[model samples]
Target: MEAVLYVLHGSRVKLACEQAISFIETCMEEIPVAIQEYCFLELADPTIEEAYARCVERGAATIIVIPVLLLTAVHAKEDIPNELARVSKQFPNVEMRYSRPIGVHGNMVEILMERLSETGKLIDKDSMVLLIGRGSSDPDVKRDLTTIAGFLKERAGIGRVDTCYLTAAKPGLEEALEIVKQSKYKKIYVVPYLLFTGILMNTIQKTIRKSLADQDKEFILCQYLGYHPLINSVLRQRVIEAGGGQDLVSRHA
Candidate 1:
């Protein structure tokens, strides 16, 4: 039997974890696989090992592991893989395949545009966008986000879009905000390129509140990228590709 194992990044916040679970549950509904299980990489119930065991107990001879990550980072590239390697050794008879993260998709840019529009503010060429990432030492994180920001700028018909990180990368949120404060753009839209609400979202809100309180600029914090339909579509595509289905053409290309 074939099984699909979804590995989430997990969260310290209960609501964040719950949101992830709910989102994955919805995504799983579209998958036709008989044995589908979800587990957290950390800070939540049903660890990867436990979930893998469940798939085996359910008579899954082949397990497809999908990392529910936004970008190609350490967690997706190393942490989860390392954990999988450890667990796979225990199930030598089972064949395991890994899938890619939802990296650099046109739908993601659409999500950003949707998020900006949700702010109910006019996005003019004079307006600037500051996209915030989760931060990673992996250079791919910066490269991919820069590409997404470029896409956002072009597609949204905006003059400029800048990228920053929450941790472990250059141009932290405070520094990015400071630079934007001195720029010519007065109307700034801050979009968190995050999946769910958690400490990072709260931190962004708090920082924006404290830093831009006295500034005369218009700062609109757009919503984080949640379980949007577009994301679900991307995950469906990922699942399809992982299951030895025909490869789909890149929409962003």
Candidate 2:
């Protein structure tokens, strides 16, 4: 039988890792894969090696590793694949295939739109959107985020959409807040392009509340993208594609 291994970028926060595992469990309910398991990339238990072993012990001849990441960062591009390569050598008989990371999918845009609506702030032409990313050293990840911001602007009919980073990249959260403060836009909606709630999300919320408490501008902080139905669909599609056959093997190797 075929097995699906969902790999998430692990977090130091316990709840963050738990939430990711829980989301994968819920996804198993809808996915047709016979054997389903999950593991963290780092900072958590059941590393990729352990998860791969468990899948084999369960009699899974073929294992499909699907990354549950928002963008094509180092975790998706290098780390996960490198780990998988190491593990694959140990279990040569077991067929392993890796799927692409979820990057700027159409459904992801819908999730952002859904999050924006949750803020209860009207998105008019004058309203500006500050899309906050986790930030990456990878230029590809930054480029992908910029494209997503453009799509958000066009689809939501907002006056402007600016991309910012929580850390590591340019236009940090504070700098982005300053830009919003200077803009003529009456309302600024901040949307986190993240998968689950963690320390980062908490910090972002706290910072937003503190910075804009006395400001004249209205800043609406939206919720992070957590286990939404559209997100589930994207994950399910990744698994299906990974399980197609050996064609996916070369992509990761």
Q: Give all TM-scores, in the order shown.
A: 0.95, 0.93
Across residues 17-123, which tens digit of lDDT does each residue of candidate 2 receive? 88888888888887766688999999998999999999999998989898999998898989999999999898889999899998888888888888898777677
- Per-residue C-alpha lDDT of model 1 across residues 11-66, encoded as one tens digit per residue: 88999999999989998787777789999999999999999999999999989898
Backbone clashes, each candidate: 0, 0
lDDT scores in order: 0.91, 0.86
RMSD in angstroms, all models?
3.6, 3.7
Worst ten-residue run, lDDT, model 2? 244-253
CA shift of 213, model 2, Å: 5.7
Best candidate per TM-score, number? 1
